[model samples]
Target: MSMFLVRSFDDPKGYIELNRPDGTLPRTSSESYVPWGVSTHGKIVYAKTGEHTGWRGGTGQHRLRPYDTTVSQNRRRQCQSELGVMILNNPSFTAKAVSKVSNAMRLYLQSQDAATAMACIYKQIGHYFYTGGRFGFGRISESKKDDIGVDGVWRGIMQALLLGRLDQKMSIHDAIGRKVLPVLKGGQLVKYTNLATVVRQDWFDDPTRRGRVNAPVRAPVTTKGGISKLDTPAGGTVAQGRNRGVDMFSRDLHRTRDKDADAYYDDADARNLLFGAGISGTTGTLLQAGIAFGKLTAAEDLKQYTLAIIGYLVGGGMHSYHETMAVASKVGVPYNPGAFETSMPESFRRSGLYTAWRANFYDIVVLGATHWRNNSGYLPSHLNKELTSPA
Candidate 1:
């Protein structure tokens, strides 16, 4: 007898297909049978048929297959979530991005001629002060319109000047050079190494080129016992010779390991200055607009103050973290948060929570004020009447 197996779509049951009563198998074409199935709980069961060869000769084979689309989709989502978490937690992502930006900035700086770059920098600095003065005075003028007089104007001018001078003194370039570049370049390891190289080069370079001639040889003094000996002990004592050798070795090692430190610092500083100036210019413009239109209530003002503090903390923390990483990488030292905290400057270390807060807070305030001013404008009287009567 010939037989075939059949299975239900929704349940596990088997049915047997037997041969005809005349003891002959029925001939079945490939497309004679249609398979149907339904999806249960996002799982689909379908019948598949193929030819199978056995002792009874070749026969048609059918099987029910199950697949869950929802499970596959969920797995895909989980994989994406894990990827996002990995990217977020990876320090190299931030470091590489920041490095790329810094490199691009450096290339731009290099492309500009020295005269042009300096001119642009100076022009930007002037604009920063000018806009800053306007914003500072404008805020005061708006708040004390009734009380503002000649003396008030003078006071505003004086205050603006003072503020501008302060801003210039605490220049953004200073922050980039003293904080950003050092961290980005991996700290004093690079700086000291470069300095040592320069020192070694100078020590080895011939002084005759600069118009300094070698000292004349002194005559050897003859001892009373007829022992002739040159003064200064023929290149000084063994200890002095050893010290010189040690110094040269140290310098050579430094140069070999950190050859481009000084050059990197200079490039990094220039790039940072250019970038910082652009940011400052944008900030000044926003602050000027805010001073022109935004009204500050006590609550709103307090919120801004809080936001500014938060911004500073975030900015400073990022800077510190990157710097710590750079330093650790350069020195072959294991990274530790406590080490970074200890290495920070006294002012920054003491005000650990407030290190980058000032810059961040200022940015937030200007941006928030600009947003409020733009959105909280007075509605036209005509529009209000139209809305009330018709809509």
Candidate 2:
């Protein structure tokens, strides 16, 4: 006789199968086998080969038998329930709203010649500098003539364009790093049900994922005394503990403080410092050259307006290209302007129109409030004083 034992961790009493030497036997309770002494949380199967009356009186050596096992239905149900909850709480909806707003703001600003408006604002602030002739080492000496001349126009145009570019860069960075990338990564997490799977898929889809997967790989800057100079990722170890995508959003929004200097700098401030200097220097040099060679002339009202429009386009285009290239490089994707065509038809939809209208309305309200504030009190008076002050 031969006996086999079938055991499962979830069951305390295991079943047994008995067979005769001819491999045939009538199934009966007395012929069943029982485990003598074994305890485990995993499945185990044992078999005895020889004549046997029962498990307690078996006269043969016992050996393990193999069998297949399946995942419990309860576990699968739990996974499905978790997935449903995650889907319900997905952040993509909010991200899409933010994206629409950002795009709309970009369109509205472009429509209104933001660069020129920015230049006019700067002029109001810088009237004192313009009045002070030969005030600095810069070659554009203040003119004795009261009217804005070629040099002044070119300076204003360049400075305004620089500011506009800085603003556009900051907006794009915030929208992408804070909103777009996080939503995308979160969607992948929900789909894959694992971080490693999502990371691998991203790597496969775009090799540049290694560079821009929102993983905090960079070591934080530290002072000579080993104090951290800025806010770093929350993980005690690099790139392992925290959710990289969420941490990235936090880092982007984190404001850094200069303890020694008693100064505060946020992401916007840092970006401005990095991009503003380069844009201003490059554009200023170009404008100065144009003025020196008589390529640029004094602004008539129409010409001033035309120059502002041109400045807006040039400044906006350069910044857009820069942002596109940066993202492409980080994500291992080709920069393709043609991809925008896919969404062109949707731009005419009612929702799109509403978003556009809402964005423009926001801009108008902001501009009107700024105008009111500037015209109301100390600002206008101070500007007037600066304008009237002698060189």
Candidate 3:
């Protein structure tokens, strides 16, 4: 019925005047205050009119009501959650429960995901060559074959493993956008739309702010290549959530609609360096695309490679556009084009491309590795033993 989230909400609080809710508090623009307009009432969220409050924290149409800690205390006293108390008290029991679930999952993944050759892309041409046939994939949810997210999340996992990335993790909390899906309830088909995509990220407000993390468009090959900041602001772009520049991942899955990517990128430098855009800001994404294409397919022949490259470009490009637009449209600044191509860091976790790419990468890791002794090699597993078989 209900689920509890694991991340803290980091959005700016609105300047709430006990009675006056005109989206503004009594404060002059001349006053030096925190990015969150700190007045007698509360946070300086956003003034649509821009007449009284000049600063715009985000693009949310409605302001969040200031939470009262007293309510939580009162609720705790009145009715305590039994499950929460048990989970907190019994650490061993919780660990055992998690292990049981994980063990079952390991079997399922090995049998179906890793060994099974009947995946989305592989189903058609799996048993053909050595490479394509070796790729692994799995599906989640009650999605059909054509769903964008079928191999999406798995792709991200593979990519994370390939890149060995472990920083600035973002957990999907809730989305402010909308997503429509067809579901059959009582054997009847119906449309399902979500209200908001809530997320729990490491740092929503200026992840690299306070002179801590230095986010560039394309990080140098070496430890110290040059000084660069986020060419784009930390607000709008699909990959803006990442400050690591390229070779990273967003790891968020905010299902959004098409109407979200029709605005300009946030131009504020408050979060970026005061000098200018990053080094790779001017560089086009075509090169990046080519690099990725080479790594994935590694086309041996010229003509086939060209044709395959074209197909992948056309398909992958569209997916990237759709996802980036949805992300940019929901939270900050106006819709800016090429958000998937642009922005800081890599938004793989929340990206459809990351899903596909990561899955392929992990296939190489798990199936191709010499750890399992299949008369060959790779991750050792005895779970594949069949009850009855003929030699």
Poorest 10 consecutive residues by lDDT, candidate 2: 272-281
Alpha-carbon lDDT, every model: 0.25, 0.25, 0.22
Q: Write the residue-wise lDDT of candidate 2 on 321-348 in tens digits.
A: 1122222222222222211111111222
Query: Each model's TM-score?
Result: 0.17, 0.16, 0.19
Taking the tens digit of each residue's C-alpha lDDT, what string does model 1 give over 1-391?
3222322333333223333343222335652221122133222222233422111211233232322232222222222222222222222322222223233334433455655543443333333323332322112233333244333433343344233222221223222223333333323225433433222322123222111122233222121110011222211111000111101111111121122333322232222211010001112221211221122223333223212211221121111122222222232222232112222223232342333322222111111111121122323323322222211
Q: Which ranges in model 2 have alpha carbons more than 4 Å from their true place?
A: 1-279, 295-297, 300-317, 320-391
Candidate 1 structure lDDT: 0.25
lDDT tens per residue, model 3, 1-391? 1111111124343343233333122345553111222223332222222332233332354333321222212211111111112222222322222222223223323344342312422333212111222211111122333343335434432332232111101010000001001111111111112111221121223223111233333432222111111242111112112222222222111211111110111121111111112111101121122122122122122112221211221111111222222232332312332111122113223444333322322211111111111121211112223211212
Per-candidate alpha-carbon RMSD to the true structure: 34.3, 28.3, 25.0
Residue 61, candidate 3: Cα error in Å is 47
